[model samples]
Target: MSIGNVSAVLVHGAWADGSSWSKVVERLKAHGINAVAAPLPLTSLHDDVAALNRTLERIEGPVVLAGHAYAGAVIGSTRADSVKALVYVAALAPAEGETVGDVFYRGEAHPLAPKLSPDQHGLIWLPEEAFAAAFAQNATAQELTVLGAVQRPISVSCIGEPVERPLWTDRPSWFLSAEQDRMISPDTQHFMAQRMNARVHSHQVDHTPIVTAPDVVTDVIVEAVQAVSTR
Candidate 1:
């Protein structure tokens, strides 16, 4: 399959939506790579994976599945024959016996990281200020405003749920580790990526590189597209 023949389907993490990949989608299209950002309910892992699989169903075969933050488990569990590659962008990939929360709270929390707690509604929201302080520390003031305004809260149940065997275990995979990330520890990212033996790309970006560093994020996805095509 050629670059134009394969598509990249992006899955946004918790507290985010499909629009999070807007810049990367634009860049992929410019390179003649079809792109789609799967809308996740963030209600539960099953719901998110089902939603991603639906988006995967729409795209043709030879697709590269990309995820950020919490969506990593979502993308990994939605493994299907249509997918030829996996891309983890500062994302998590919990083992079969592990829950999202298990790997999420694995390392010591960053001092600048905000404390997370679910509201009465059972949704965990990123405090508005945390957008600039932790989530996207490198984002501009304007970008921070947009990120905070359009934020979506994730269900507490989402992380509590355990994951099945992830596709990264066997598929061609790429991982982009955010070195300056405060959300998910950079150590955790490196550990997961290395455990999967994925081709790794480390950067001095924050948690949400798809927004703050689209070029870095897009380049890796582009590389994944070309890589699977050769295989």
Candidate 2:
């Protein structure tokens, strides 16, 4: 199975946009694979999924959808037939009838994890300090600066809604568990991966490994792409 015709749609998580997958996009391209960073509005779960589907619609063939952090729930909610496999990168995977918050808070929080609250606009912004302290502690200082500058606050409604049966149950799935993630506990990642029966690839990375450890992130995504291609 030649993967030359396949595409990889990389989705970003809350508090970030499409550019978050820049490193992974470049890495995937180097492997002779086509990858696109799907921009998510961070407005609400519905809006994010719509945005992701829109991107998926533009691609010409089968897709290996990869989502990071909060985008995990977004990818899982998608019902697109073109999406053949799912790759969860330190992401949250809420089951049918479960809200994103339910899975995100499944276990104890990391001491360094920021205390988040919605503002008057009902949007939750990751504190600037959290970019380095927790979100991506392993990222370079320059990377942290860019991450903070381009962050998009997520609306409270995004995490409150329950998802339908996730696509993970219908397709082959892979998970990259960020072992040292400060935002999402490693235990929670493992729990979700096991629940979905996804192939787990655990690594000692931070919450935002797409920026801090692009290689690790791309490795899992490429693995999913290959699996989809062979199928």
Candidate 3:
């Protein structure tokens, strides 16, 4: 499978929807790379993984699975045979028995990071103002406003659950390091990427590079697609 011969499935993290990968999807389609964004309910890890699996089931050929933020853990749970590669974009790749929160709160929070608390519905939401301040500082004012408006709330149960064996252990993987990320620390990203022995690509981007730097993000995805296509 050549890069052009494979498809890609993109998974977005908490507080965002498939639209987060809109620009990346457009660029991939332009490259003749069929790509789709999986819609996560953000209700539970099992639910999100099942959602991704449904998307994977629809594709016929080799796939380059990509995840951002929380979806990294979602993708990790996949054992789909069609998946040829893994691309983690500032994603959390928690090992066996480790919950997302375990890795997330491993270190002191970044000073500019927003304080999070679940709402009455047991969902964690990014404050409307958080998009501009910490979530996506590289995004335009208009983008920040829209992000806040269209954000999805993540369930608390999802973060506290442990992940299955990470798919990266069996599949070739690539990692993107966000040097200026305010959500997940740069050090944590590095550690996760290094731990997975992934092909690491570091950038001085914000937490939401798929929105702030789509071209850069697309380039990395293309790299993964091309790599997996050869297999």
Per-candidate local distance difference test: 0.92, 0.92, 0.91
Candidate 3: clashing pairs of residues: 1-229
lDDT of 3 at 119: 94
- Structural similarity to truth (TM-score) of each candidate: 0.98, 0.98, 0.98
* 1-231: candidate 1 lDDT, tens digit per residue: 578999899999998888889999999999999899999999989888998888888886689999999999998897689898999999999988799999999999999999999999999999998998999999999888889988999999899998888888879899999999999999999999989999999999999999999999999999999988887
Error of 2 at 53 (Å): 1.0
* Residue 179 CA displacement from its true place in model 1, Å: 0.3
Candidate order, lDDT descending: 1, 2, 3
How many residue pairs in model 3 have overlapping backbones? 1
Clashing pairs in 2: none
Weakest 10 consecutive residues, lDDT, candidate 2? 1-10
Cα error of candidate 1 at position 111, Å: 0.4
TM-score of 3: 0.98
lDDT of 3 by residue, 1-231 (tens): 466779989999999999999999999999999999999999999899999999899998899999999998999999999998899998899998899898888767889899999999999999877888888999998888879989999999889999878888999999999999999998999999988999999999999999999998999999988877765
